[model samples]
Target chain A: MADGTTTAELDAPGDLVSVADRLDGWLEELDEPETLVEGRREAWERYRELPMPQTASEEWRYTDVEDLRPEDFGFVEPEAARSVEIEDLPATVQEVLAGEQDRSGVAVQVDAGEVYRRLDPELEEQGVVFAPIVEVARERPELLEDRLFSSEVTDAEEKFWTLHRAIFSGGYLLYVPENVRVPEPVHAFRYLEREDAIVGSHTLVVAERGAEVTCVEEFLSPDLEETSLSVGGVEVFAGENATVRYISLQRYGRGVEHYSVQHATTGKDSHLSGFNVALGSDRHRADVTSHVEGPGSESEMLALWFGDGDQHIDHHTLQYHKAPHAYSDLLYKGALTDRGRSVFRGVIRVAQEAQLTDAYQTNRNLLLSEDSHANALPNLEIEADDVRCSHGATVGQVDESQLFYLKSRGLTPLQAERLLVFGFFEEVLGRVPVEGVRSRVRSAIERKLGF
Target chain B: MADKLLEVRDLHVTVEDEDIEILKGVDLEVDHGEIHALMGPNGSGKSTLAKLISGHPSFIASRGEVLYEGDDVLEMEPDERARAGVFMAFQYPSEIPGVSISNFLRTAINAGRDEEDEISVFDFRKRLKDALELLDMDESFADRYVNDGFSGGEKKRNEILQMAVLQPTLALLDETDSGLDIDALKVVADGVNRIGDQNQDLGVLLITHYQRILNYIEPDRVHVMIDGKIVESGGPELAEQLEEQGYDWLREEKEPVSA
Candidate 1:
């Protein structure tokens, strides 16, 4: 609308008008460095050029998004900088923050701008950069452009990926220098409060060689009156011998539709662990990948989701083993009730040079209602002969015998089911090393169970 | 209240999904503080009767009345029966992974009591410790998942431990001696006797194929079940007679009567 658009691009079609039409306006108000703007412009071009995902594609066979009308959701322009204290935040956001009292830093974002950001002075003095990406890009744009625009780190070529890159806002950048180990986790909270708004946020973590850090990202929103969209991205770079742990809890309201792409690449001898707990949103599709690119690297991916009230959730995971002597393990579990459904597609791909690559993947789903459904698809593509790779999947209902056994002990039906559900997820929950994060996840599960 | 702690009168049952009958007009009674041993070979519906009294969903009572303390037990659910102080030590207990025994037992105890009378953690721990010691179990056993990866002997011991903690008014031991060795059987029988002694009004229906368990836990009455019906009821000697005669003489005596 500002006269810089070419006639040919403007004439594209009605389908691209909603999100694409607002890109230029959002970019103008984004307030970033020139280099970052240029990168976003290129991403916008690619976003317009790529076609929308279709169910005919193998990647989306079980999840259909044709009914989504992007035009119905409007993008919010960047909000003016305002001083927002922790007490002024929503109760839901405050409750989550209170769960992790030992966090070294915390950032809270609402809609299109960050509301509050804080970091421990000691960590900042140690040359660690933990702040909003927009603020950091204003000072050193190169630091962000290099990672944001890197194809090797974010290989997702979907339309949503391009859209997120073009207009991601309110994300945090965590940078730990070599040999620095942060004792406490850094927390990032993203919340959506506006109705019929499309919110896109990003998270970037760079743990340099010999560094160790743990970061937890929590997403939550109040039950909105109208449906909205959330497109998110997370990129992690674990350098040689560095140890990084990233945990994300998605607890959006039922009126929200979410699409997230999470990618992590590990260097030699680096250890990376990612845990995702998704229990919100009316519809959500998450693509989580762990790229083991260096020898002696280890990656652990764990996720759990609970769906109720006709919610539809889908997850696709990739364990890409490109170096020898790398180990990757993934375990994803989900539960559904009240006609809710879930889809899981996992791939363990070992490259030819990746000998001695040990990869294991397991997906289990518990159906609590007869009408609830789940589909699990696990695949292995190993070009290396010496690699040890295995995958397993199971979709089962709550065992009546187990329920009876618990009930015979005098537990009420609801209590029995709750205990069994927690029991089913205990294996993964116990694996979470952080006490604060584990308890927060446990409380979230209790909330989902309507306790 | 009823004179008998448990009264099963002319009870008949069949598998819920199958047409075959399991319990054919079974009749039995156990007074307060009495131990009645129901003996029969495999497939004599010994377990079915216990399961039916416990309200297992698989077995539906076609015609009968199961009265516990003058209340119709057939009208209640399994959980309701459990809350009413009726307990059954399963022949093969279900394994519930990831649920610790301590947590499960605490939840069960709290569920069976009134909301305001819920047991505190300290009290529950003390009771669990006492029960474990009574069964000669180590403290670590309570930390393990409920019956998961437990040996057969351990499973039986856990059942007895649960019985000790719950302290039910009526207890049904369904083939509790089947999978136990001589030592395990002795430990389990000793546990039952100790619990019975502690709860003076406790009534037990001990179902077993062999009379070996009767040696430790004396029985006031022994009922012989052959082909879904109790053929004879006598004192503890009936158990030894069936154990020695191998249920054949009873079967032969019944063959002429049926013909």
Candidate 2:
């Protein structure tokens, strides 16, 4: 980014939106190769052409983004963070860093830049590349140049996609070569400490043939007072016969507005499964997709969300089957409390050549209060008659019979409801392959339920 | 007579939000060390009375009173009633997936304990072992999710196991033998019989639709119910008479003498 410090791009007074106009400085500052620098310029051009979504836009009809006027938010410096030592971190981060649980490695990121990362010496000897993208650019420039701006997501086609490309700063690059299996999970934490600053980062995970790996990334905010913004994206590449699991947990404070796009591409005979747990954020929009491009590929997409207060959480997913004998399943479950609201929209598409494909999508929501709301839309498009695809969704309140059953056993109404809610989430959380992340997600859910 | 374990005086209960009176002025009593069988035909409001005593919100107790050892229980919450030692083995136990039986039962036991008298882990384990042996249940049963994917008879057995662990003063069995084979029936009846023998002051109210379960666990008193009211109260022979002639004779007797 530009040396050390730069003034924030304050929007003009009385104007509702023009935040997208500040992308010129960010795009010019991106440290990139000559070939991709041209791509970045085009991305900026397309971003200018792409219109910010209005309230009635079909892409976000279920969610109203009218309040997100560009004039209300401004972009901060790429490395705008007040560095803190590990011991001076929040108790939550300290507890995680104490190494009570087994992890392959851990990295701490603030303001889209990694401050500290530690990996086992054995992994370095084994030639596993786990480091921040900037370090990767300096040490392994070709690897970053090849995969940096090249993802299944188009740069300027969608507003969020274009915005992510034009203003993105720093993120993680996890590479596991052929036949290498990381025995334990790798962890990364992303946070923001400055008020009225915006962070856009991208995470890329490329697993070579026959590789197996699991990585977890969490997002946090130091305070919940002033408005902050975070725009992030993830791309996972699972090579032939490779198995990859990537989990992203977003718990930004209430004053933060978050947007992310998580997508993965699986090749022949590969398996890709992960989780998206969106627990906090005043307004969150996460777009997650899985594309099965090779024969015998499998993809499992799972998500869990809890929206309390007036929080608005949105999750959109796409399962694209491109080759024969591919299987894809997506399940998104959420619980809404108080005046909270959530939206889940998932689509499964099987191309004509994708015969013998099997796909299923389901969304289940539990409304803890009458004031809360949940909208689920599951769509499917099959160009092949031989494919088997189905979608189902259900929205209801806490089961009265189940609640009474618990209360009758001597638990109060609150305890019974919480237990039942936990049970409701267990069905999908059980699918989380990594034990450590699963337990962390469990504790987070418990905290949400307690509140 | 020994101290009264439970007393019901002219109890009247109706379905909440509707004028449908399910338990119409029913009166009954069970003293210490007594086993009472409440027998009735299908749709005879037998389950309603069981739910009423357990303080189910769906049932409104319009009149009368329920006293447990001289304290009024009608005003208490369901959980309060449970903590006060009133246990009702539901006819259809719920399946709580993802929660193991051990955790659920421990919570129940912990809820019933006084803050200062919380059971130690050693004691809880010992009690669980003793109860398991008394019920002839396997060790794996404690780890399984509570009633989730359990067979009909297994659910009934789980109910008895809860009773064995809780050791309530007044135990209400609501059709606990309806869906059991003869072997499963013996296991459940044997467990209740052993509990009764051990706790001589414990009172048992076994509600059943048929006389099959009464055959396994002999009762000190039998009451015949029809149309939400008890039609006959006598010795164990009352259950035998209803099993043989069915509720037709009781219906004929319950009606006023025609003309």
Candidate 3:
């Protein structure tokens, strides 16, 4: 195991290492197991060696990542482990947070790297591990060693994941032992405090054989005033016959910039579903990929985003079928108002050896204003002739007739437009099984719509 | 004259992009407590007239004045017109996906009511329940998205439910009877009739391509519009005569005037 170099070793004139070095110093004190330390060291070296992705790269043709230099932002260290005051948040955020607490069985609040509170002690007694990433590393080194910073099954050669692996400061780590079923969802909340402050966090989840767990990660900022940066990575491992539902709601302030990468793998007969709701951020990018590594595994991916003002949100999803008889489905939808812009690129790939694979991808966008824009690209690649793969994309504005119908019933045009946009988003939001999480997402969407 | 609900004087409207004048110098007046049925053929501009009165942005009113409760409605926005007690039940209502019917209705009701006096959630729920009961709508419908995945009959009934809740002074039923089965038509007409009976001062401008809805909700006056103009006017018997003889006789009578 090795610890990464200090700021002095990496910083140079006109180089971004000075900011990166500051971030490194903040993470240097985080406790990690020997294996994880070694993995992170290797990841840091790899990040230094890898080149930033450019628009010329086929994988990043539609995305412009050159503007995301590290020098543009400063590193944010956890100043004080202050409890998040819900009353200080926007009414929409407060309502959503309160609603989730009322409905969910387990709620864990992570303020920066600190775990402020954890609900449902009984479930914690049932061999369910829910704690800060640092504690998890110290308590369950074996599980962390096996999965932490592991990129063998996923496509992690990208610059963003490399940087995330090298610099992630604090995150949540959840583990469900064999044969245990968690009825209530495990919640993780991460709050970003300063604008233009870089935040790199990682979440690792493992569910042993026949175990079931649901985890929700919420990202929020104080308001849309700061020009911040958040790069997050999450990895999920579902053991044989296990089931895991993961939801990530990124409701950053409008001034923040965000990039996220989530990779998940499922074992034989395991089921995994992931949802993402993007309501805030001036510019946001999310790249999520799921791999069915064992037969009979199933993966479902759903996303909904509402972009307003000058916000820009981009989402990319991939479902890779590596084992035979695996099923995967992806649906992403967004509504753009004002001059906001959004892009969605989704792909479903079935490997040659993955016979009898079933894969589907669909992306839909609703443009709420003439000035707003949306772009969708859906692709499918099938190497196995017996496998079924399909993809589709659609971009459209709200139907004027529908708006008229609502307006005729005394709804103002804005109210009618909001209703139509909400309806357009329902296709993806409806699939979320957790009522509280779904309501929270709904409230966030309404708030973004200025309801 | 003081009790007149809607008065259209020389309302000239043109269908966008086409030289066709759908509502050509049409004159009509509907008084409070009266149900006026506007019957015409496919190209008779019945729908256009209804749209013009409701302030649809697409319709260009070249020369006309639409007075709703004695105010010029031609300059008003669609929502403004609605708030001013003008309502039009669409022929094909748009389906809104994520918004629940309950939320949509409440927002509409609140927007139409006094802005300072917000209705309580309990009171709103009570009102919604009463209206839904009147329309025979299932309780589940309130939770479902507005008009999303609704059957044709269900959508029409929902329109009437909205009308009942809004309680507009001037209700324009634009082809409300179209695309509905006989059973659905009766249910929808019954709902409209109930609203009319309950709000006796409500004035209705019922626009229809067929006379079937007239059987259940009898109209006090009937007017035949052809080629964007009111060609003939009479009592309810005119609707029956046109339904029986078709617009062929009217077309022949108007063809000479065209030359």
Of the candidates shown, which would achieve the greatest TM-score relative to the real structure?
1
Regions of model 3 farther than 4 Å from truth: A1-32, A71-112, A115-119, A153-157, A194-197, A223-228, B114-116, B257-259
List chain A TM-scores, every candidate, in order. 0.92, 0.90, 0.87
Question: What TM-score would candidate 2 get against the native?
Answer: 0.92
Ranking by TM-score: 1, 2, 3
Docking level of model 3:
medium
Please give, for residues A1-451, the per-residue lDDT of candidate 1 as tens digits. 0112112210111222355467787677656777777778887787667666778887888888766655346766655334466776668888877665788888877787776777888998998988777777877666676686463433333677877877777787899999999889888888887777787888999999999999988889988778888989899999999999999888888899899998899999999999988888899899998989979999999999999998999999999999999999999999998889999999999999999999999999999888999999999999999988999999998889989888887888888999999899987888887887777777877887888
Ranking by lDDT: 1, 2, 3
**What TM-score does candidate 3 reach?**
0.88
The per-prediction CA RMSD against the true structure, in angstroms, equals 5.5, 4.0, 5.1
TM-scores computed on chain B for all candidates:
0.97, 0.96, 0.94
Q: Could you tell me the TM-score of chain A in candidate 2? A: 0.90
Off by over 4 Å in 1: A1-19, A25-30, A67-72, A79-82, A140-146, A151-157, B112-114, B257-259
Worst 10 residues of 2 chain A by lDDT: A9-18
lDDT per residue for candidate 3 within B142-234, as digits (tens), equals 998888888887888888888887788889998888888988888888889889889988999999888899999899999989888998889
Model 1 chain B poorest 10 in a row by lDDT? B250-259
Q: Assess each prediction's global lDDT (C-alpha) against the native.
A: 0.86, 0.81, 0.78
Model 2 CA lDDT for position A332: 92
